[model samples]
Target: MSIHTFQLHDLEIGTLHDLLLDAVSDTKWKIKELRQTFDQTDQAALLEKLSSIEFNKARLETYTELLEQIDSSWCPDE
Candidate 1:
């Protein structure tokens, strides 16, 4: 989860695809939470929201790289 280094070659293609789907789900959920929080929040809430947004951004970046790696090696089912 360092957003850079990994040996994904050990994983099954289907499993890797599931991970991709999970990333999609996570980002979607975080985006919704951030949207709601920003619409109405106090200073304290704003700080927490910023932290959450940072985590979401990192996760999004990780998955983006994962996506590119997967895309590079993708193939049709045999």
Candidate 2:
């Protein structure tokens, strides 16, 4: 087996928070598009895709909430 090496650095909370926000935005857009597609189509596979997209949207929203909480409580005023 081969091994991997990497470097570590301090946690950039602000950057992380921004990334979470972006993820939430992207997921929401996808959910919106999928919903529109779902409304236009009448297929089982499309339903499944919508379900999956909604699930992911929920997960991203949850993460965004958590990040907001952390930013409010832990991050200092800027």
Candidate 3:
């Protein structure tokens, strides 16, 4: 599998939020597909991958919530 690299600082919060949501969705689908085809030999590795993906998803959710709060609370001076 190939991992894509990005300069996260270049992206706006909303863009990053969208990207993270897409990533979480994709990773979750991959996890579900892998679970369907899992065997005894793949159990450890598969579970590890799923756990990592879940952790990332949780982190993304936290970040998204934080961004939402910031967006809602922030007030720009006119």
Candidate 4:
């Protein structure tokens, strides 16, 4: 199968393992960022808001990368 075929298959499948992996990856990523923020002496009171903002930022990055990948290979109405 081609890479495009594989990507299409991946997008179609919504397995429990994928959901769990994404959640685990996001949590681990957030914790690492928070640790870095603490090491840099960021304000404590803003951490709650920072976490929310960071979560959105991380997801946006993931989405942008996915779009970029599709842009490189995807052909509309093919």
How do all models score by TM-score?
0.57, 0.47, 0.49, 0.42
Q: After superposition, how far is residue 39 of candidate 4 from its true place, in Å?
A: 25
Residue range 1-78, candidate 2, lDDT tens digits: 111121123335565566567767766776777777778785875786676667666666655665565667685569
lDDT: worst 10-residue window of model 2: 1-10
Report the C-alpha lDDT of model 1 over 7-76, residue by residue, as the tens digit: 6576666765676677577767766776777787666776776676576577657656766887888887
lDDT string, candidate 4, 1-78, tens digits: 111213434662244246436756766766777777777786873486476556655555555455566567767795
Candidate 4, after superposition: displacement of residue 40 in Å? 24
Clashing pairs in 1: none
Q: Supply candidate 3's per-residue lDDT for 74.
A: 68
lDDT of 3 by residue, 1-78 (tens): 334444534547777678777878877876775676475557777777777677667666656665676678668998
Is 3 or 4 the stronger prediction by lDDT?
A: 3
The candidate maximizing lDDT is 1
Which residue segments of model 4 deviate by more than 4 Å?
1-8, 12-45, 76-78
Q: What is the Cα-based lDDT of residue 41 in candidate 3?
A: 55
TM-score of 2: 0.47
The weakest ten consecutive residues by lDDT in model 1 span 1-10
Query: In lDDT terms, how accurate is model 2?
Result: 0.60
The pairs that clash in candidate 2 are none
